[model samples]
Every structure is written in structure tokens, then in C-alpha cells.
Target: MTLLPDPIISTWLFSSVVFGPWSNHVTGWWEKKQTHSKLLYLFYEDMVEVNQITTSCAIKMLLELEYSIQVRGRVQFENMKKNSFVNYFTSLAMDFKISPFMRKGKVGDWKNHFTVAQSEQFDEDYKKKMKNITVQFHTVV
Candidate 1:
């Protein structure tokens, strides 16, 4: 979850937000998109297509934000896939008994999780929610 530095202080929930959202919890990156034109939204599944390049882009983004050398080095995409993300988030979910933050982290895991009906529902909801947005989903899977 990340928050914008506004007087209203809109908070956006990433998928990793364990408990989901609250009453006034801001949803999506809409605010971020509007406020920070340079923001890049990355999906984990898309990273499967070009892990190295996407990781480099992420590192470059963090570098632009002046991340400390240690933090930057630790955030390498391979490390995120193996140690930093899966193990750490699995431990978090185990500690809490909720769905793990690292839910497979694989492209097409949705096919296993979502039934046809569920997938249709998601598609409809996504279409409605993202009506005017120009986001792209990878098709290489």
C-alpha cells in the first residue's frame, strides 16, 4: 500500500494489502496516475516475460528515487522472485493464516484459482473499473 502526499492523503491498496481496504480506503493507482505522471505500474505476471529487463527498469526507477545502495541491491528481480518475495511473504501469510502474499507469482495462476464463472465476473468488473485506462496485459503466456 502507498499513500499520496496530499492533504486528503489518499491511500491506495496494492494487492499485497493483507486485510484489504477500509471504508475510505482509496482504491487503484488512479490518484497516483493522475498526480505522478511518471509512475509505472508493473504486474508480477508480466515480469515473467522479461524478468531481467523489467527488473532493470524497476531498479532504475528506484535509483531515480535515490534508494540506498543496500536496498537497491536487495531489490533485484531474481532476488524478489526467489528469496525476498516468496519466502518473506509466505512467512508473513503463515504468521497470519491468510492467503500468502506470494500467491504463486506465476503467469496464468489465475486459471487455477478462478473458475470460468469467476473469470467472467473478474473480466466484467475489470472492464467496468478500467473503462478509460490504457493498461496492457501481456499475451505471451
Candidate 2:
């Protein structure tokens, strides 16, 4: 029911064609992980736990990585924002000043942007598209 173009739930379905859509890209890799022994695809929430307000493996990785100056230098966001070398593709895709790359970063923040009608509609579409997805991602919002 939410008509807003950027609502988080629907974005997975209708994001720009340049990258296909998030759902397809994610489930593709999720499905791919079945066949590829070395492929590792983790949800963003799994990577940035503090920022995500959800489960994250990053805190442990960060602590383990503290001794490595090389790893620490590239992982910080402010540094990445300013480092054209790391943000080349992001710069081409988005102007962070106009619409920040990271907003609240909350799990259910999409509900804030959706009207009741929009929410209902999104719920319906989401159900249909995702019914076949067996891999489940859970987050407490």
C-alpha cells in the first residue's frame, strides 16, 4: 500500500535496474552459496552490528583486526566517504549530502515511511515475491 518509491521493503523489489534489485541480487548469491564452496555472502546487518542495531560479526572482526593498521584505515565510514579510491562507485551512484547513504539504519524503519494503505500493499507484494525464499533473515526491531 505504501507508494513511496524509497520505502525499504519495496526497494528490494523495485530498486534501479542498474544493479537489478536487492532481493534478486541477494537471493541469487544466497542460492549461489549453495553450489559454490568458497562463496561467502553475509547480510549487511551481520557486518555492521553496532550501526545496524542487530546481530553483527563485525565487532569481533574489528577487535581481531585492531593490530592491523591497514585494515582499520579502510573500514571507517568517514574515511571511506572521503576516500575516492574506496567510494568511486558510490560517488557515481549517489550524492550523500542530498540523500545520505546511511539513514537511521534501523530494521523496521521502513514502516515510518509507509502509509497504512501502502503498508498493506507492500505486505501483499512482499509475500508473493518472497514466498519461495527459503533462507530466513531475522532481526529484532
Candidate 3:
């Protein structure tokens, strides 16, 4: 069985925590749709899409934008793509029988799991909840 038995519940909770008010406050930019000099909003999909060959360049640019610091060398970037960090973390999670931090790591994986009715319900609920929110997600479904 998948670690996340209920994708809806898990997705809701993850979204609520990651994109919720708390995260916005921490970043100090989400509430205000306009870009802040001090805050750099970096979406994982955006970064990956910007350069599919290597996310290092995108990540470096984001860091520079956020901290105004120069990130030197390709070593760190190569390491980031190696999956060593993810493997280590996932191994720990496995030892504890906890949900894996990294699942399929593929975009639009929900299409494989969510039923038609469930997808419709989620979409309706999402639209209603996000109607007043400025942040938008580029979802596949």
C-alpha cells in the first residue's frame, strides 16, 4: 500500500501547512501578490521547468535572489541531483516505518490515484477555498 492511503487528506494537510498563512508570513510575500525585494518565491515546478537538465542553475538563481549571495561551483549542484540526501532521509523514514518523504516524485501522479468523482469534488472545494487567494498552482488535473 502507498504510504499516504488517503491522498486527499494528505494533500490538503500538506497544502494547508506549506502554502497556508504560516508559510506566507514566514516568507513575507505570499499575501502580497507583488514581489518583495527581500522575498523570493520559488516554486519547485517552476525551478524544475526552467531547466530540466539541471535544477542547480535555477536553485542558484533563487538563492541569489533571496539572499543576494553568490553561489559558486557546480559541485553542490551535482550533489543536489544525485539523490543522496533524499535516499538518506528516506532510509531513516523506512527504519521507523513512517511514510516515505519521497514517493513517486512525479508530477500529475494524482491522475493515477484520484477517481473522477473525487477529482471533481477536490476541484470544487479547491476553487471555493482559493477563490479569494492570489496564489495559484499549475496543477495537471
Candidate 4:
């Protein structure tokens, strides 16, 4: 599950891809229903981090949960470690100019996009909506 960015930067993309079809309400409901074991939530910033370790861990969990595959010692595991699919897919996305998907894939990019008022409003709304949700996001990229 992809996480929404902090309200500061999220306002710019809130109505776009960031929260395009899903909201915290929907995600919270799903998280409650599935519980942590069945549902793995991943943050985009973490996934695109400098080392990509978080992304690798998410991929490993997906393989284990969805396919019931033990990632260690598997061909799929080795390929993922080498980021074969991720590299290829990123290249394709770059070729297509999918800016939202590829642009400045980093943490704290919201600092570059959001105004103070917008950020405060988003924070208020986020706190109200996500108050009961137990899942927390990583603040660092």
C-alpha cells in the first residue's frame, strides 16, 4: 500500500495521483479489515530511498504474502536484489515522461511545493481523518 505524502507537499498532488482514487478513510478501513499481517503498507519515499532497501523489503513481502514464496534462495529473490524489474520499469516510465511517477522521487519534496496555509489545512484534515489509524509513516526518506 502506498502512503500519502505529508500534508505540506501533498496538497499539490492531493487531487492528482497522490490521493487520486483513495483517501485515508479508505486506507484505514482496509487496514483495519486486513490487519498488519495480511496487508503491507509501504511509503513511496521509503521505496525510492537512496539505497532502495525499503523497496526491496516491500517486494520481498509481496512475494511471500501473495505468492507464498520464500524469497531467500529463490531466483525471484536474486532478480529483485539486482532490481531487474524495477530498473526496467523505471526506464519505461522515464521514456513515457510519467512525471508524477518518476519526478524527484524523494522524501520532503513537499517542502518545494506547499504553502504554509495549505500545509496547515492539510495537517488538520489529516489528523482528523487519521486519528484512529494505528499505522504510522516514516518521516525520513
TM-score of 4: 0.49
How many clashing pairs does model 3 include? 0
Best by TM-score: 1
Model 1 ranges off by over 4 Å = 1-27, 64-98
Look at candidate 4 and give me any clashing residue pairs. Answer: 9-110
Candidate 1 structure quality by residue, lDDT tens digits, 85-136: 4446333435623444454445765566455665565566556655666666
Tell me how candidate 4 scores on lDDT.
Answer: 0.52
How many steric clashes does model 4 contain? Answer: 1
Q: Candidate 4 residues 1-141, lDDT tens each? A: 233455634554355443342355456655775655746565555544533465456556666544434343232333444553443444342453334333444477665665666658667766776676665656465
| Model 3 alpha-carbon miss at residue 8, Å | 5.9
Model 2 C-alpha lDDT per residue in residues 1-141, reported as the tens digit of each score: 234654654555567654556567767877887998556555545545554332223434434644455544555556556666653445355665675545444566666667777668656766776788777764542
Cα RMSD to native, each candidate?
A: 10.1, 5.5, 6.8, 8.2
Candidate 2 colliding pairs, count: 6
Q: Which candidate comes out best when scored by lDDT? A: 2
Model 4 is weakest, by summed lDDT over 10 consecutive residues, at: 68-77
Clashes of 1: 0
Q: Ranking by TM-score, best first? A: 1, 2, 4, 3
Per-residue lDDT of candidate 3, residues 19-89 (tens digit)? 34333353345655365554455554554455443344454545654432233332233444454554354
Candidate 2 residue spans exceeding 4 A from truth: 1-20, 44-93
